[model samples]
Target chain A: EPEVTQTPSHQVTQMGQEVILRCVPISNHLYFYWYRQILGQKVEFLVSFYNNEISEKSEIFDDQFSVERPDGSNFTLKIRSTKLEDSAMYFCASNAEGDRYEQYFGPGTRLTVT
Target chain B: GESVGLHLPTLSVQEGDNSIINCAYSNSASDYFIWYKQESGKGPQFIIDIRSNMDKRQGQRVTVLLNKTVKHLSLQIAATQPGDSAVYFCAEIGAGGYNKLIFGAGTRLAVHP
Candidate 1:
């Protein structure tokens, strides 16, 4: 079974530094999404992407966040400046066109900012 | 604002027993619901999903029940095993454009020998 893959399983960065989390979604998937789960909190949606444009984003996804599909296979999320509260598990997900509601998620990248 | 919540924070079950996790969603416009299992340090894995038009759906040893009237969803696992232990979450997707998913807090399932 093909699954979404994320790079840098764990990332540590200094506060005020920039961090880019990378993901390679399933090859055939058309829709991609970014989500974050704070320790001991529910997973929260960050943004959704389709056709190289952001479809929707949450208040949590503010000015500091940006997503890019720089290549056919790579989707990346960049945080302009990291903060202590920015530490969390960031997940990437994708879905085939036929089943838009069912998304396959990657193992996730644990971002730790200090 | 829409919210999804689980009935309990934790559930403990004997190895051979069946386990059921319940969720309540407050989005009437939600047309799709999914159940996901998240082990420690991992992302949510899709288990099963049901549409608003369907009352029930089954896959492998798992079954999902949906009640549109009460806005309730439940995931039942048969012959629960230690490997089945994890934090289970229920997510809902509205009929809106983005197809963003809102997840519940989640229920921690513990299977004991």
Candidate 2:
């Protein structure tokens, strides 16, 4: 089965530095999303992307966060300045249809800020 | 202002036994619910889903029951195996195409062989 894939399975970055998490959703998927889970916490939605633009975002997705399609296969999340609290597991998900409620999730990228 | 929740945090059962994971939701308007299984170091995988219009839906060895009046959902796994050990979460989405989801803390199931 085709699955969503993410790059840099694990990353470590300085507190003030920038980090980019990459994901390649299923080729035919139209709806893309970014979510995060803090350790021992619930998965929180960050933003949703469609038509190469942001469709919706949460309060957690503040000024420091940005997402880009960049290319056909790459959906990326960029954090301008990482903070200690920015460390978490970042996930990317996609849905194949406009009305389909099912979303496929990637393995996730573990971001560690120190 | 709604939430999806699980009744138990952990459950253990022997191989060949049946397991039932329970969940509760506060959103009366939610029309769709799903169960996701997540093993350690992996992402959440879809198990099965149910709609408010229906009371039950079954897939493979798993069955999902939804009680709309009480706002409850349950996943019943028959003849559970070791592979069934994982964290099970109940998620609910509101009425819409792009409706966001509310997830429960999750129940960790351990199927011992």
Candidate 3:
């Protein structure tokens, strides 16, 4: 079965540095999303992207966060400046146009900021 | 604000026994619910889902029961095996434009042989 894949399974960056997390969602899916989970915390929604635009975002997705579909298969989340609190497991998910209820998730990128 | 929560934080069961995990949601507008299994160092894996229109659905050895009146959901695994040990989460998709999933605080399931 086709699954969503993410690059740089583990990323370590200095505080105040910019970082980009990349994901290749399942091909043929129309909607994409990004979520994060702090260690020992529930996963929180970050943002949703469709048609090359952001559909919705949470308070955690402030100005520092941006998502881009630079190519057909690549969906990336860029953090302008990393904070210690930003360190978490970032996950990318996608679903087909007709199946909005079932979103497939990638293995996730563990971001560690020091 | 909407929130999804699990009834228990951890459950331990003997192998070959049945396991049942429960969840409760405060969002009445949530039309769809999904159960996901997340093993250590892995992402959430889709187990099964049920729409608001249905009260029950079954897949493989797992069954999902939804109680719209109480805003509750439960996942039942029959003849649980050692491999069934993992953290289970319940998520919901509210009625809206983007179908972003709102996940619950996960319940850890441990199966002892």
DockQ of each: 0.87, 0.68, 0.87
**Per-residue lDDT of model 3, residues A33-86, tens digit only:** 999999988888899999899999988999999999998999999999999999
Residue A100 accuracy (lDDT) in model 2: 67
Measured against the true chain A, the candidates' chain A TM-scores are 0.99, 0.97, 0.99
Q: Tell me the TM-score of each prediction against the true structure.
A: 0.98, 0.96, 0.98
Candidate 2 has a TM-score of 0.96
Model 1: share of real contacts kept: 0.85
Encode model 2's per-residue lDDT on B33-100: one tens digit a residue.
Answer: 99999899988898999999999999999999999999999999999999999999999974444646
Error of 3 at B51 (Å): 1.0
List pairs with backbone clashes in candidate 3.
none
User: Candidate 1 at A35: error in angstroms?
Assistant: 0.4
For candidate 3, state the interface root-mean-square deviation in angstroms to 1 decimal. Answer: 0.8
lDDT of 2 by residue, A1-114 (tens): 999999899999999999999999999998999989898887788888888889888889999999999889899999999999999999999988754678899999999999
Q: Give Cα distance to truth, residue A17, candidate 3, Å.
A: 0.3
Model 1 pairs whose backbones collide: none
Least well predicted 10-residue stretch by lDDT in candidate 3 chain A: A37-46
